[model samples]
Each structure stands twice: as C-alpha cells, then as structure tokens.
Target: MRVLILGGTREARDLAAALVDEPGVTVTTSLAGRVRDPALPAGETVIGGFGGVAGLRAFLRARGIEAVVDATHPFAATMSAHAVAACAPPGHGDDPAGALAGDPAGPGSVPLLQLTRPGWTPGPGDDWHRARDLPAAADRARALCPPGRGVFVTTGRRQLAPFATDRDRHYLIRAVDPPTDVLPPRHTVVLDRGPYTVDGETRLLRAHDVRVLVTKDSGGALTVAKLDAARTLGLPVVMVDRPAATGPVPPTWPDVAGVLAALRGLAAGGQAAPPA
Candidate 1:
C-alpha cells in the first residue's frame, strides 16, 4: 500500500511516523517548504508544491499513490482545492475540459482522508473579533488599537502584505521565516516557531504592551497559548477566519490516532474512511 500525505502540521508528522514502519506500507509526506527549517516527518518527504491540479494528478498517477491524506494547514485553501481535483476520477475534475463543478462522478478517485483539527471557540473573558481575511484583520487591528499602539501579529510571513501600508499602528510580527512581502513602516519581525507556552506568550505581549493581538484561525491545542496570553491581559484579538473549504467535504479525522486506524484499515481492505 502506498500513501501520500499532504502534510505540514503536527498531526501530519504523527501520522507519518505511525505508518512508516507498518508492514506492506510505503508512506510519503509532502511539504510546501515555506519554512526555512521544517520539522522532518518520519517517512519519505518531498518539499514544495506539485505545480497545480494537473501536475498533481500526473505525479499521483506516476507514483502509484494508493491513498491520499490531506493534512495541510487549515488556511491552505489553494493546495487543498488542488488535492480534491487531482484525486477526482478521470474526466471529472477541475480540468480545462470534461467535468463541470458539481458532476456526480467527481470528488474522490484515490482513497482520501481529511485530517483537520477543529477551530477555536470563544471562551469566557475572550475579546475575539472575527475577520474574514488578512486585510479585514488589519482593519480590525487598526480599529482596536490606538495610533502608535502595538499590535502583535502572529499571521505568517507571506500574509503580511495586507497590512503593509498601515503606518499608524506599530506591529510586532512573529513568523518562522522573515516576511517576503512588503512590511509596515513601523514593525519588528520575531522569527520564531511554536508549541508555545502561555508564560512565554504572556511575557512577549507584556514586553510589547500590545493592545491588539492578530492571528489566523489555524487551530490546534499546541498553538492556543497566544490566545490565552491575549485573554490574560484583557486585550482584543483580531481572529482571521479560515478560508472556506471549496469542494465536497471529505471524510474527516479530528486527530492523528483516528486517521492512523483508518489508514491501516484501508491497507487491509479497500474502504479507507467513513462516508462524508
């Protein structure tokens, strides 16, 4: 059995590790290579995009990938869309010709399992302002913070373009890589990765005296410390929502344990996951 994991998250790593040594299984993981030094998963790993949908389909066919598990970041809408199309049955995908958008023959060709963590829910003492996207979040941040006030931005490097022209508020940007996009006039980039602690997150927020916290809705328990820190200081958060999923919802597994079992079952039989 061959499996291709579209991975970059902790769950992806955990799943790859669990399946690497299983009998009759060959697991390969793919990364976007956005990070300078990404945490390597256990099995075979490939970096960078597989072009677009057509390229992905060729690669899938060439590699003889039996099953595909989409474990990309929740905000990775484009890649996720490509995965759906590439795995769709022949003449039933997002091709230039053939299948229309809602064709019944489309959706899944190879067995697909979705491994997505749930989004964070607002809790007591949380001052969360939901934004539709980065530009909207930037506007919300400007509204929440006074001129010359600090805004802590945990949104990734490539996402900084939307906030570039805003010169009123000072930004404390945190990302694993230095931002490639145009930056705000008054901003400091903190290159850091996380499985962060609330104590550390609190200290950073306190040090900057931030009035507003801006972050994406990339959810998982490991990354919730910043939200906790913001809540502790009674600061307002500009929570950018995840881009909506584009196609038919695939079978979903909330955690790595569930997906591991499902994939093993798939190797033994033909059915990989429960119905959508």
Candidate 2:
C-alpha cells in the first residue's frame, strides 16, 4: 500500500512515523515549506507545494500513490479542500462550499482521508468571545482590552494586517516566525514555538499584563496552554472560529490512531489501486 500524507502538524508527522512501520506500506510526507525549519517525519519526505490540483494529480500519478491522508493543520482549509478536489472520483463536479475544482489523480479511485483534532470549547470560568474572522477578532480585542493593558495575539504571524489599524491597545504578538506583514504602530514580536505548559503560559501572560487573548481555534494540545492560562487569569479571549469547510468531505478522523485503523481497513480491502 502506497500512501501520501499532506503534512505539517504533529499529527501528520506522527501518522507518517506510524505508517512507515506498517508492513507493505510506503509512506511519503509532503510539507508546505512555510516554516523555516520543520520537525521532519520518518520515511520519505517531499518539501514545498505540488503547485495546484493539476500539479497534485500529476505528482500522484508519477509517484503511483494509492492513498492520501490530509493531516494538515485545522486552519489549512485551502490544502484540505484541494485534496478533496484532486482525489475526487469520476464525475464529482459539484462545488457546494466554494471549493476549488480538482482533477482526479488517475483512472481508479485514489482514496483520501483527513485527520483533524477537535476544536477548543469555552468551559466554566472562561470569558470567551467568538469572532467570525481575524478582522472581527481585532475589533473585539480592542473593545475588551483597556488602553493601558496589552493584547496577546497568537493568530500566527500571517494575516496580522487586520490588527494594524487598531492602535488603541498595545499588541504582543507571538509566533513561530517573525511576522513580515504590516504590524500595529505599537507592537512587540516574540519568536517562539509551542507545546508550552500552563505555568509558562501564565508567566508570559502576567509579564505582558495581557487583558485580551486573541487566537484562532486551531485545535490540538501544542498551543492550548494559552487558553488555559487565560482562564486562570480571568482574561477575556477573542477567538477566530475555524472557517467552515468547503468542498467534498473525506473520511475524517480526530486522531492518528483512528486514521491508522482506517488505513489498515483500506489495505485489507485493497481499497485503492496504484495508477497504471
């Protein structure tokens, strides 16, 4: 069984590691290359984009990939949508959720799966304010945070221009990479990566005197400490909801183990055949 894993997140890496150990399974992981230095997965690895759906289809045919597992970040809606399009079976012409149309990889069905972690939910003692997008979140953050208190922004470095116009509150932006986009007039950048602890998150929040926490609902435990720290500090959070999924959905799982089980089932059933 040949497999292609559209990867970036830890889940994708773990899935690749697990699949490589399986008998008769040839696993290859593809990364978007947005990050400067990424934690590579076990087995064959391909860096950079496949261009688009047509390019992806050509790659799949050339590599003889039998199956695809899109274990990308929850916020990577475009890639996920493209995977559905590129792997769609014959005559799947409908585009309900504004998905980009894709060309099939080959003659027969090239089975695709998705692994997504569950989103965070507001619990007791959580002052949560949901925003439709980053612009909305920026507006809500300014309103909730007083002039003197700073706002901790963790919605990644990209697309931060939405918050640039709001200079009423000082912004403390944290990301794995330094943002290259237009930043707010008064803002500080902290270059860091996650899997952070609650204690560390609390200390960071305390040091900045952050009154408002702005982040995306990009689920998983790696960066969830910020949410917990905000709860402990009684800080209001302005969360940008995950974009509604567009395009044909695949067999989606919440964890690596579940995806492994499904792949085992596929291998047993000889679900996908390598393009000839």
Candidate 3:
C-alpha cells in the first residue's frame, strides 16, 4: 500500500519511523519547508508545497497514493484542508468541509486520516491572556513592558516580522533557527530547538524576568512548558488562537499512539478502504 504522510514535526518523524519497516507499505513524508534543518524522516521525503488541492490531487493520482495521513502541525490549516479537498471527489461545489456538494466521484474516494495532539488547557494559577491574532498578541506583549522587560516571543518565525515591525520594542525571540527573511529589529536571537520542559521554561522565564510571553496555541505538551512558566511567574501571556481548519474534519487521533491504532485497523483492510 502506498501512503503519503504530511509532516513538519517530530511527531511526524515518529510516525514515519514506526511505519518504515512495515512490509509492502511505502511511506512518503512531505514537509512544509517552514523549518530549517528539519528532522528528516525515514523512506521517501518530499519538501515544499503541493500547489494546493489541485496539485495535490494530481500528485496523488500520479503517485498512485492509496491512503493519506495528515500529521502536520495543528496550526497548519491550509494544507490540511487541501489534503481533504484533493481526496474528496472533485468539485462537488460545496464548501471545503465534507458536504455532499463537492465529490465529483459522487461517493467513493481515497481515505484520509488526521493525527492531532491534544490542545493545552489552563490550570489553576495560570495567568492566561488570549489574543485573537498574532498582531494583537504582539501589541499586547509590547504594551506590557516598555523596554528591558525580557520579552519572550514564541509565535514562530512566520509572524515574527510583525512583532519586529515595532522597532522601538526589544524582544528575545526563540526559534529553532534564525529567521531567514524579514524580521523585527532590536531583538536577541536564540537559536535552539523546542519540546521544552516546565522546569526548563520556568528557569528561562525567571532568569530573563520575562514580563510578557507570546506564542501560538500549537497544542501538545512538548511546547506547552512555557505556558506553565508564564502562569508561575505571573507573567502576561499573549496567546494566538489556532486557526479554524477548512474542509472535512477527519477522525482526529489524540496522539501518535492513536494514529498507530488507526493504521493497524487500516492495515487489516478494516478501515483504509471503506466499502462503496
């Protein structure tokens, strides 16, 4: 069976690793090319965009892809929607979500699966400040401290340019690698990897006297340690809400383990190809 895996994180790697040895199963992991020096997966790997749903559909048909599993970052809404649209019967004319409107094939189409980690919930003693968008988050973060407040910006490199737009403000940005293109000035760049711990995050927050924190709701425990630290330090956290996913909302696995279980079910011919 041929499987295409949309990947950009370690969880994707883990899933690829688990499936690498499966007999008669060929796994290809597609990266979003947002990260620098991403953790490579085993087996076939493809980087860059799929040119949206149409391009993805063509690729799937050309590749003879039998099944698709979307293991992208929870925040990667566009690609997720594209995956569903491509797999669904062409041009049913309905909204991106699985309405009867689109489906050119009428009913039968390829199987699509989603692997999503659980989102973070605030606990007691958590000083959570919610922002509707990234720009708002940056504005709030800047307003919290005039200068030298040791701001921590973890909103990923994509939105960093906006925060940096406020040149008068100084920020301590944390990303896996230094941002390539446009970025805000007056910032200290910290090049390190994530999946940090609460203890480690707390230490970093306290050490920097971080008065304000900014990050996206990217869900999963590995990156949520800073949220806890923000709560502990009584620091104001400017959180960007996750974007709404467009298209059919497939069965969402709680984690990689659940994904494995689903894969097993599919492997048994019990799930992958649902009867027409």
Runs in model 3 lying further than 4 Å from the true structure: 93-108, 165-168, 272-276
Report every candidate's CA lDDT.
0.84, 0.84, 0.75
lDDT of 1 by residue, 1-276 (tens): 899999999989999988887899999999998888999999899999889988888888889987888999999888888887787786666441211111224443576678999899889999999999999999889988999889999988886888888888888999988899899999999999888999999999988879999999999977799999999999999999998876656677888887877777777774554633
Weakest ten-residue segment in model 3 by summed lDDT: 95-104
* lDDT digits (tens) for residues 1-276 of candidate 2: 899999999999999989989999999999999889889999999999999877787788789887789999889998987787667654552432122111234454477877888899999999999999999998899889999789999998799998898767789999888897899999989999989999999999999889999999998989999999999999999999999976567667788888888788778864422111
lDDT of 3 by residue, 1-276 (tens): 788899987778888998888877889999988776888999899999989888888898889876678899888888888887787766642443342112124443556778777667778877677887887887788888767567888866666666767766567788887766467777777778877888999988777667888888888767878887788778877778888755458767666777766666666775632211
Off by over 4 Å in 1: 94-108
TM-score of 3: 0.86
lDDT of 1 at 255: 88
